[model samples]
Target: MAIEAQAPPPSATGPAVWLRKHFFATWYDTVFSLVFAVLIYLALKAFIGWAFVDAIWRVENKDLCTHDAGACWAVIESRGRLILFGLYPYEEQWRSTLACLAVIITIALSCLPSFWSIRRLPILWIAGFATFVLLMRGGFAGLELVTSEQWGGLSLTIFIFSAVFVIGMPLAVLFALARRSSLPVIAKSFGFFIDIVRSLPLLALLFAAAVVVPLLVPDWLQGNKLMRVVIAFAIFFAAYQAEIIRAGLQSISQGQEEAVAALGMPYWSLVIDILLPQAFRNTLPSTINQAVITFKETSIVTIIGFFEVMASGNAAIGSGEWGNQYVEVYVFLALIYFVFVFGLSRYGAWLETRMRLGHA
Candidate 1:
């Protein structure tokens, strides 16, 4: 007791201290960290060298990139128009550009908290979609009318994805409600219908919509292959989304509904005012995941002869001039998809954080 006091251990804080504790805390961790650090450095060095230092960036210098070890980004520089607009008339491609911008702006607006209300959301989307269609179709004002067949590339992909989601969400709510109805017959019937749709492959459903539906439906009812396929895609999306909503509904307490009923609230009012909102909040993550999947699945329309963005990329690389640069085209296409998908993921995370804070 009469000796000296020992110094306190050094605090394991700050950047260097924290890094040492986390990455080199033990022998195995230190070894693993060193190994991975070497691998990452090598990868980054090679990627930077190939993608920037040696890459071809100019359209006129594309020939120099042929058979070279570096990336051929010049293909993108040259064929960007073809990749973006596809078969849309060259002069009228301006309309396609406007339509694409409209949809993109609509999507961006929808992500904002201020536009989260049901009334505001619907009005925003409807006006945005209407503007998109009017500009693309161009039957009004002094613009020429372009049919659905003429629509392709990124604009077509966005249109199909948005149409499917907008149409499917309401149908999914109906299906979920029907499946949970008190009436035995209605519940059983909807359950069976959902089963039937869910059991079939999406490809088969689209094929039937594109090829078989016209034979059975009336002339005016058939509309166009694009419409028919969109309806079918919506149904497919609804079948899965319905189950998600139903699960959300089931997660709600029986007492919550009973309490609302005891207050003399009408069934529709109780559902719309309390139950549906809570259910959607509970299932937001799953809903966002389904939306992402549906957006990616829009590419399947290409099989039925619709030239969406994926098909446009394929066509961009199919030519003799850029045939060897399929990798470049595909990489560009991946970047496009990553933009939308990553945005969706970040929006979902933001929604979850905001809702959690609200509940807290």
Candidate 2:
């Protein structure tokens, strides 16, 4: 006698299946999930009510804000300019705004894959930086020249970030190569140099450059406070980045280099054409990580009297009128930081994907 064939198990689909699998897979899971769902809903509702429903938005109505329960967003509306531009001259603030946009556009253009080549990248960066400096400094085209001391707010932050990255990246590559030198003396010396710099706190380094170096160096050598700080920051960034790059170099198989050498390629060609490319591709993520850290560290310059974004925020709240709105200013500052950092991370991920696909 033939037995009836068994049917395959039925498939679950859509929201009901998802709920059963995740929330009701076990009794404890079901209970916890329901409890969490209620808590999340209540929290979200409360936040929405405070942040939007009861929030005041008019600058003129800022006095209406009480110490009761609602968020005082009107403070932000009234004082947003001061938060963004700080002690930047009100009439010249438009120049700062345009300069900031120029820097942002430059950063965006640099991140695109199309400008990745050596010829294009240098030209793009130089032109971009020139425009940024020209617009901000304003010595050309009949515009008044603004000194570094006069620079403040988001413009200062952007300037520091760009200058540090541009200078630090090449220095990092050089340091990494030197650290990996075949000669023991050179490698050891480079390693010690990197270690010494890396061991020092960024604040100490910035302090030394901003204050100590001036007393020791010649008159002309002692540049603007901003330049000194940027140089110090670049040194600090390079030290950390060099180690990351050397680690990437170490990750590559010796056989690949050996094979290239056996093919009669010159040492410089082997390094430039094969080794450096592979090492950089391998270390792109780490490089981006270092960059993000450096970008955040720019806020430290405010301690040395440079009015970066953090300083601007402080100025925004320090004013007696909006003294209680420090939290709002900080939240806005955080959003700006998030935008830059998030964009950098996304670009890094894109570069990694491209490298993996052999596009780099």
Best model number under TM-score: 1
Task: Report the lDDT tens digits of candidate 1 across residue range 119-188.
Answer: 9999999999999999999987889889989899999999999999989999999999999999999999
Candidate 1 Cα deviation (angstroms), residue 177: 0.8
> TM-score per candidate, in order?
0.95, 0.93
Off by over 4 Å in 1: 1-10
Please give, for residues 1-360, the per-residue lDDT of candidate 2 as tens digits: 999999888886899989899898999998999999999999999878877888777878788777664677877787677667766777888988998888888888988879888799789889887887788788778888888777888888988999899889889989999999999999999999999999999999999999899899999988888888999999899999999889888998999889987999998887778878888998998899998988899999988888888997887788788887666677788998999898889989988988899853
Give the clash count for model 1. 0
Q: What lDDT does candidate 2 reach at residue 191?
A: 97
Q: What is the lDDT of candidate 1?
A: 0.92
Every candidate's lDDT: 0.92, 0.86
